[model samples]
Target: MTGTDAKDDLHQYLREAREALLWKLDGLSEYDLRRPLTPTGTNLLGLIKHVASVTAGYFGAVFDRPFPEPMPWIESGRDENDDMWATAEESREQIIGLYHRAWAHADETIEALPLDATGRVPWWPAERGGMTLHRILCHMLSEIARHAGHADIVRELIDGSAGRRPDNTNIPPLNEQWWLDYHDRLDRTARATRA
Candidate 1:
């Protein structure tokens, strides 16, 4: 299609992933949002923080736009994985606000540059340092979507809520008992095939 149409499509998908990730925070307490539900310490708020850093870097520094805020967690000489989780002092509102701001900044970069406009990713290896706005969009879209899936599982473990989004679950209309039975069937089948 036209250039505008292609850019809009990519932006739309990126927005969808962002919204899905944020929706997981709804109705959750600060404690619940920060609780490490998985063995790897995958918390809801942390995912938001991480994605914000990611988008800000990809769409900002990579494009030479530079998100207007300092991200100490991602700076050189910081503890490894600092961006992967929020500190105890960091409130949900703070992290979420930064995420929203990052979105706005990234949007500015996306709007100003054509999809084929080139830039260098300083953090990337030499062979892959050169990039285009289109490539960054696709990469961020995939990254956000992958983390959104993680948020889905972590959210389900917390409260039994599971869906693509609030308005569109896209899952079968199965009752709790039906789901339990479905899992039971799978369990039995796996057991039967065990070596």
Candidate 2:
């Protein structure tokens, strides 16, 4: 494939991962969106916030095109995990808006530079500090996809809703009874194998 085609393909997958991550928030109330379903305080809005912060840094600072905003939480000497959860005052709209802005900033960096364009990740260890657009794209893709999986579980716990996106369930067609039987069979097998 040509260089432009390769970059477009990578960008497309990155967009898909971003969409899947954001889709987890649809049809949910503010409380549901910020509710911490996991013991580690994993919430939907917080995930979006964290991704925004990281994306801004990776695409902004690393590429020497800093995002035009202040992010005190990302500064040194701040509380740990500050980016992973939203404050009560931080509304759902605010965090989601920041995420969308981050997308635009990241996209600009991607468009302005080729995949082979080199950059530095100051937060990384010295030996691994140097990186390229291609590497950062893959890193961000993995990061977003991992959180999207977390969101899948958190959304399911908040309500029984699950799947990849709103328009596409991406799961086999099976009735409720079929799922129940499937779980029951697995339980039976585990019980039978118990020492």
Candidate 3:
């Protein structure tokens, strides 16, 4: 890809990943969004919240800039799994809206800065010094993609809904014959193990 095309591609991937993450929350109750998928309390809403915080950190505060809106959890010393689970006081709209706003802020930073532009990550390990906007954008996209995969699985478990975005050509179809074949193999395996 050319320079402009590569930037657009990366930005498009970031947007799609963000959308997929939010899509997992669609048609779900507030209770469902807050429900823990794993023992660590990873939930849909919490993931969005966490991403917002990290995005603000990398694209805003890390660049010696401040985000227009404040994220209280970072100051409240409750960041842990707080992003993965929503509290009673936290509404679905609020968290999702914050994520949308975060995307706007992150996009601004991406637009204004060049890939080679550098910033400090004070929280990172001492051995690793600061990083560039390019690196941070790549890191954010990586993080979003990882979390989006987790969201896909959790969404599937919740409603048996699974497919990729756009054309959804990545999804495979399984008919009743396939199910029967798989079950027959499982039954044979069970008989052999018992024998």
Prediction RMSDs, each to the true structure: 0.9, 1.2, 3.1
The count of backbone overlaps in candidate 3 is 1
The order by descending TM-score is 1, 2, 3
Write out the backbone clash pairs for model 2: none
Better of 2 and 3 by TM-score: 2
What 10-residue stretch in candidate 2 is worst by lDDT? 164-173
lDDT of 3 by residue, 56-136 (tens): 888887787778887767775665655566679988888888898889999998888877788888678856758988788
| lDDT leaderboard ranking | 1, 2, 3
lDDT of 1 by residue, 134-163 (tens): 999999999999999999999999999988
The number of clashing residue pairs in each candidate reads 0, 0, 1
Q: How accurate is candidate 2 locally (lDDT)?
A: 0.93
TM-scores of all predicted structures = 0.97, 0.95, 0.86
Candidate 1 vs candidate 2: which has greater TM-score?
Answer: 1
Better of 1 and 2 by lDDT: 1
Clashing pairs in 1: none
User: Between 2 and 3, whose lDDT is larger?
Assistant: 2
